[model samples]
Target: MANTKQAVPDTLPLLRDRIDSIDSQIQALINERAQCAQKVAEVKLAEQGGDAVVFYRPEREAQVLRRVMERNEGPLGNEEMAKIFRQIMSSCLALEKPMRIAFLGPEGTFTQQAALKHFGKSIVSAPMAAIDEVFREVESGAANYGVVPVENSTEGVVNHTLDSFRDSRLKICGEVEVRIHHHLLISPHSNADEVTHIYSHQQSLAQCRAWLDRYWPHAERVAVSSNAEAARLAAEAGKNGRAVAAIAGEVAGEMYGLMTVSANIEDRPDNTTRFLIVGNQEVPASGKDKTSLLISAKNEPGALYHLLEAFERHGVDMTRLETRPSLMSRWGYIFYIDFVGHYQEEGCQAAIAELRDRASEVKVLGSYPVAVL
Candidate 1:
């Protein structure tokens, strides 16, 4: 028994030594991979003429993940393998060219989360005060790409984003959808039962109106500019141990030094928001693509119908359609649409040409790869 116990202790040490050796080997391989990524950056830099060209490709990253999932073995699940490759590609892309992404922020908003999720932590992000400001940043060359909320699955389209597209010439280069989980956050010292008022962005407050009405019947619901800003104010005002909370994310908890009192407070459990990437140049066709356009109808009956009929005739699919009152004329409206297929495809070209002849105005915003979830 004494000999067996001694052997057991020695064997455990040997196993530990083997594990340490394997960990060292893994560290060396990781370093070598990083070096290879830097070399790739050097080659891309030379090809694109110094530092001007944008090298981080969102669509390429999606393709890489899809391929990784397809080739993954059963020992590790597909999602697990894809996540590993996603981070690997993120690191490699950082070395290629650190993307500068702009999102609706004061930070800690769901839009910011979507931007980071889509671009990964490798990107350098800038926060813009307004959704329109995010679009303008990318339009004016201040930001490489801008992420703005386009719509919420439950609450419907964000009118501000649609209105901005009416006049801006920016193109939709990519898209991302993020699941939103709102929390009731308060200062560490504040008691949840003693809360008097709750604050959040106008949209957020509106989204959770039903829930708040049922729960905090007497507490005043206030709207702020953004969720993160609301959280900041809640943390700052909790000095008396009386002021209440803000509806924001757990990530925003540390940002404002607030603690989450209640989690997942949104009306819908599956609430999600879709965001768009706006840029100056139109991306070339990826096999699976979406094209957006702004079309104005002539001052005649059946004008809008005639425009949509072209899609039916060409067999092109219209994914989304929205009408916004045109600023130029009274009672006039512009129709914004998202359609399937690339602009280069024969059917798509035919549809555009037909709409050009049939509509008052038709502007092709651009065709880009379908967004990865």
Candidate 2:
């Protein structure tokens, strides 16, 4: 090597100067991007003649994140890069309007974490006590968007969230998946060996059942309204020197000043929960998308078959199919079908048209961009 490092030192001072210069450039470019975002707001207002403009378009943001990931040549992975851009987009959007997002929560819940991940920290996250309340919050204009858990890898479908869609006029604008990590947490001052009872949400208790049974079998496992609530209960009990512990996530543990006795105690290492973003506005196609539909099959033999056959005939990829008890008829069933294509697309439209001719009722819940990050 011809003394490759002789000219410039790889010293801290030199690196600091280079990082400072890079930071300045990044700051300048971010401000320029913000200016462009502001101009976008102006253009929309001018074009619509001051009508209500949806500043936060789910499809648009999804497309932007997808592009960011695609172009990333990172030492940092694509998700890490996309997360950086997500915050930038969040800040720029805040210049136009700060979104009020609602989630089934009491702060520190996974649903709240998903909401923040989807909308970024600039949003106003309202904690609703129930799934229906989250839907109502967005529907009543109390919140710009609502996030509710739809299904989990370990537990299965969230029936309450599914049933809410049956009657709500609100549309599914987007979907977010959250990796669930359950921990056996206790207050710092509490004695782990003295733990007498464990608390968590029912689903959480189920997810961590094997682990808890293995290590904490002697402790009484109690199911509460939510893991965050369990954390609070554990903290309260711990302060009084009672033998209580909670099974929750890092968010809850941090919130309650708890220390983890066991980490990632979930039975399934890759346990994840999928949440839906419910909003008033209908999202347009964003290249890669998914469509959700609620249908009532005619009470006849092969009624459901004909409805499903249309999707196959039209070459639409059906992703998920769920059945809920139909209120229209006790013996009847409401079908919740999710497919991999925008409802407005030719194939999806053709399938739906065939479905309308076959089923007693067909309702397009929404067509939204698929999750990118």
TM-score of each: 0.88, 0.95
Query: Worst lDDT window (10 residues) for model 1?
Result: 1-10
Candidates' lDDT values, in order? 0.83, 0.91
Among all candidates shown, the one with the greatest TM-score: 2
Compose the digit string of candidate 1's lDDT tens values, residues 1-373. 1322243334778878766766787678767888887887777778887646666665566677677878877788987877676677777777766778889998888888888777777788899999899988987888888899988977888999988887798988888788888888999878888888998988888778888999988999888989999998898878765777899887777798998777888999889998888887667766778888889878788888898999999999999998888878998888988999888899999999999998889988878778654
Model 1, total clashes: 0
Which tens-of-lDDT digit does each residue in 34-87 have in candidate 2?
A: 999999989888876553788899999999999999998878999999999999
TM-score of model 1 vs. true structure: 0.88
For model 2, name the residue pairs that clash.
Answer: none
- Candidate 1 overall Cα lDDT vs. reference? 0.83
- List runs of model 2 lying over 4 Å from the truth: 1-9, 49-51
